[model samples]
Target chain A: MSVDARIARGGVLVLWAIFFGVLWETGASARYLGSRTQWIVPFGTVVLALAALVYAYGYLRARRGGPALTLREASGLFALLVPLAAVLLVPHAALGSFAASRKGNGLHFLSAGQSAPSKPSDASFLDIRMAEGDTAFAAQAGIKPGLRVHLLGFVSGSSDVPRGTVEIARFYIACCVADAQPVGVPVDAGRTFAKDTWLDVTGSLERRGRRFVVKGERIVAAKEPSQPYLSFRT
Target chain B: MERAGVAAPTVPSFLRLRRAWETGVVSETVFGRLLGGFVLLVVVASALRLGHGPAAQTFLLVFTSIVIEALPFILVGALASAAIAVFLPERALDSLARLPLALQIPGAALSGVAFPVCECGSVPVARRLIARGVHPGAGIAFMLSSPVLNPIVLASTWVAYGGHARGAEMVAGRASLGLVAACAAGLAIGRRTRASDLLRARPGERAEAHDHEQGDRATAFSTHLVSDFLFMGKFIVLGAGLSALVQASVPESALSTLGGAPVMSSLALMLVAFVLSLCSEADAFIAASFTSFSSGAQLAFLVFGPIADLKLSVLYGATFRRWFLLRLLAVTVPLIVIGTLIFEAVT
Candidate 1:
């Protein structure tokens, strides 16, 4: 092969390895990779490797019987590959950062009037000391237990025992919508609404022995809030 | 002659010392392409990384789960295309071409149920089928339906919607409508054009010549695989980077602009689909994220994305021609719009 062709072929191989290697590494830490690191590391490595390989391959091939790749040709190939490779790598990097930032944060609170009820006030504060099984009310353990706090969520399901009582639910998303977990707050509204109906209620944090429950009055039906689901807030 | 201290040219030194640095090394094309890629990378990376609080994190996680897991699978698809070029029996494809369109359409749609693979995986398979002599229309139809109707996508959509009635309604509605649209487009284009017109394959004799020269099937397969990897490596990187940039640059609020108006929403969602080019397996979750939009609009997002999108456009451009892609986009966009409308009316 001509030096140019040989260099191009070698450049292609090195570029392939670098791109795949970065992809593999990014894939491995995709769930936890920081956004900056994800984009820069994977794509940067691929670009640098490609440049070096093309240059070296061209020179070596020219020295041997192989065809030489001109600087123009090498650079042209790099230009094409770099952006294309970047396109692929960027998402992984962006997602990695997104995942990290979203780790424990609940879903975007879509309530018009009330902020998502959090113990620490700021949604960014993740309660690491809190036990996994603990409910939101459980976080209020030592505080005056019966303090009335406004709560809002969607009705997940209803209970038949208390005439027309229902359980209102919301999901907290830690990252994407998939990892959302439905969290319920029991409501004793006199009438029943359909499942998945959005509602707002004035409720007091109640402890039925060790169990935490929301005992509320006047559950009112409302329009579906944007992002009605609850996501995890880390 | 025997001069004292005369040194011979050593092969290793000669190899090492060869002046490789030529002037005018970087051309405008190379510089431009690399710079464009770098800019895109930086923009996307910053968008993903610099955001504060929960929203940023949610975006990141969603991006990762949906986009990252999809890369290897796509690479496999590209690699598979290369492999088919290397080793698969070309004659077997003739049987597929001879099958009636009636059998072919449904058969292609149902084929998705057999595999959990996503749209990216389908690309290579479709290409291989085309190379093997399947009608371009049939192969295209299979590509469209395979991702949406696949078992994994169905199951995921079902899980997201929370049961049989809703899930069935969503899947059946989207699947049937998408199938009709894709098949219609394929048939329309297929009638006027020959399969050879779509993608110019190497002459059969040349392929056969390469096949004979190789010592054995294994060696040929390996060679083809390596070349295939090299051929597709750049595109994979490009596709991934473009997806990231779209994810980062476009805000979720941008979706809200199209809310309530089904037509506008459909168009906007289609644009998003084009830009995001998300893997079909996980597009459901992203679609669900567009909670503000109606089911019809969400359905359009899912249907349009798998069939035609930026990444797919690039891939198609790489394989086919600009004229073909432009024609494809013209057909596919209207079909998706009509499908979305039908879904809205029925559901």
Candidate 2:
């Protein structure tokens, strides 16, 4: 209703534009948005920045006109600060083992590798199929029980499996963290690792009841992948 | 009607100020008091080291992610809405309203195919449409349809279910059922209500269209755009916070106890969709991940989510009256359920 109020609200929009720009430039969007970082972050930044400039131009056109912003309006504008505060105050981390506890560690998540090589030589390929429980594909790939497989994933302390085993899990994010689902396999590594520890696990694949279990023969520390979350696009 | 030469009765200063405050014209002192109280609460909360935990971390991530994900769409909607308000000819709007109701509702529902915005963007546009004298039912139909019938959403649905045995069926069912639900809900909501009764009044907002001068079109557009974005953006932020809390705290299994039964599974997934408040374009992948649920249940999720969700509920609250959500669900739920069941029976 007032030029000052418009400028104040526009300043908030500018702050958001800055936030999004920082998110895109610093690559922080990947931790929260995953694959969506490529488009959403830049687009949001541009839209917000242009909107802010438009708002500022109007305020400049009528610099001294109208009443001040009302308390309710001011409060509503201030409420936008919540997300900014949350983003700043909360420590940022990738969704990991703790998140899996709620989202579950299941292989039901769809994977990009719907069709793979028969008798695949790559251990990761076998590992993914085993995780997906694609017995037909596994059979085609000659991946039977006791076949040696090397898989890369972070350890998750999933209670779905037996006490002696921890789940080795990877998240497949379709959009953002809200839609992320974990695909994991129960593995017996002899020694326990911290939750979310990246590990290169070379193990013999075994079937126990409905789920696959990995008998780890060689376990080594592995760095988290540059693109930690998996997506069909990549 | 005052008597000639009679002086109007003057009120006491304190009484006038009290009346002003009660009528929503808050004084600087009242505003400062509120600001001070909020600052004190924040300081106390910070001193307590609140929001420090795995759950809080998860909540923060989800909350901010949802905000970041949804804001761009809301901004787009605001810009589109402002354009409609400032640029679209009044005669064009009148022509839209002049159409027969039967044709208008269906036509508006199908128009979503041309407008690719999702639910977040649709809300502001719908509000502007109603304000600009479009048939309220048609505006409502347009709002409900754009998110689901849009090409991007259908393409995503097709791709998400591409690996499934009934991918085509899912896409077809989603499109058809979504259109049906949108029209039904629109007809029901706009049946007896006026636009003023349906939409919330924005405080300090300029009068809708009468004040616009020919030269001030750009200024008016900027005003509407900024106002709509800020208003809608705050609610989305608050809504995202609520959704994040539910997503972080509630175990998925807690709601899935009835995931086995056909009717109950549909209801359960609908509840999940509400709680998750995911974007329509992205929700199909999440629905596809529910391999344990039936196809009908997944369909329920895909259909129910874009129409109503935690985020949309908050936005709706800010936009419409209390009865809006109830009226919406009363019309939409049964249609979606019956549709899904038929989908299940057919396939």
Which one wins on DockQ?
2
lDDT of 1: 0.54
What C-alpha lDDT do the candidate models reach, one value each? 0.54, 0.80
**Model 2 chain B, TM?**
0.87
The numbered model that scores best in lDDT is: 2
The residue ranges of model 2 lying beyond 4 angstroms of the native Cα positions read: A1-3, A63-67, A106-108, A111-132, A139-152, A198-210, A217-228, B1-50, B163-165, B207-211
Model 2 Cα lDDT, one tens digit per residue, B1-347? 96689688899999877655534544556656765886676667556766666688778888988998999999999999999989999999898889998999999999999888779999999999998898888889999999999999998887777635566888899999999999998899996778998998876555324325535776778888988998999999999999989889887667666577888899899999999999998888788767788899999999999999999999999998888999999999988999999999998
Q: How accurate is candidate 2 locally (lDDT)?
A: 0.80
TM-score of chain A of each: 0.39, 0.78
Give the Å shift of residue B280 in candidate 2.
0.4
TM-score of each: 0.58, 0.88
Candidate 1 lands at a TM-score of 0.58
